[model samples]
Target: MIPAINIDAALAALTDHWSPKVVARVNDQYVKVAKLKGEFVWHRHDDEDELFQVVRGRLRLQFEDGGETVLEPGELCVIPRGVMHRPVAEEECAILLVETVTTKHTGDVETPRSRSIAEQLA
Candidate 1:
């Protein structure tokens, strides 16, 4: 049986800015939290969808066609696989990510800014 966990407590343990400290896991998927700012690399996942939620501050997702959506705190969006999108933050923003085990944070756009960690906890 899996033990209960306090996500708020786990979120507090993270200190490194922009790094997603794994908070928990749901089966083969990982739940992570991170602080983001400025423009991020454009990328796409060929297999799995990417879930993004703005827990605080504001975030914008830019698509290849130049379309975008701004997500304020409490808003969430899921970018389907193979869709090119870039995450942008006007200021320090807290975000929650739900992704599969093998999903790369930046997907196909490999970059130095990708959040690193083997997997998260539950």
Candidate 2:
């Protein structure tokens, strides 16, 4: 039998902010967890949509269109492919993400906070 994963335990093991760790896989997608604080770079995935779910604290997604959405714990948002967005948190926040295996952590732009697939898998 496949062992169940303890999300809290997985989250606790993370020591870096803005870095995502892969926790599971579903077909062509990856389920990841990340601890984030401060603002992230603006980027867009041309072909893969991304899903963001707040696990703790809060998250604010700022869109290139000048619109923004704030998500509290248990809340989730689906970012359509090709829509530019940046994620920001006033304090440390935990989040779960679902994205295609081909999706880039920073989408179209690479920043200092970006994490590669290999890094995330490791």
Candidate with top lDDT is: 2
Q: Which runs of model 2 end up more than 4 angstroms from their true locations? A: none
- Compare the candidates by TM-score and give the number of the best one: 2
- lDDT for each of the candidates? 0.81, 0.96
The CA lDDT at 59 in model 2 is 100
State every prediction's TM-score relative to the real structure.
Answer: 0.86, 0.98
On the 0 to 100 scale, the lDDT of residue 78 in model 2 is 99
Query: Compared with the true structure, what per-residue lDDT tens digits does model 2 show for residues 17-44?
Result: 9999999999999999999999999999
* lDDT, candidate 2, at 47: 100
**Counted clashes in each candidate structure:** 1, 0
Please provide the root mean square deviation of candidate 2 (C-alpha atoms, Å). Answer: 0.6
What does candidate 1's lDDT look like per residue over 21-108, in tens digits?
6677789888888888888888899999988998888999999998999999889999999999988898888889998878887788
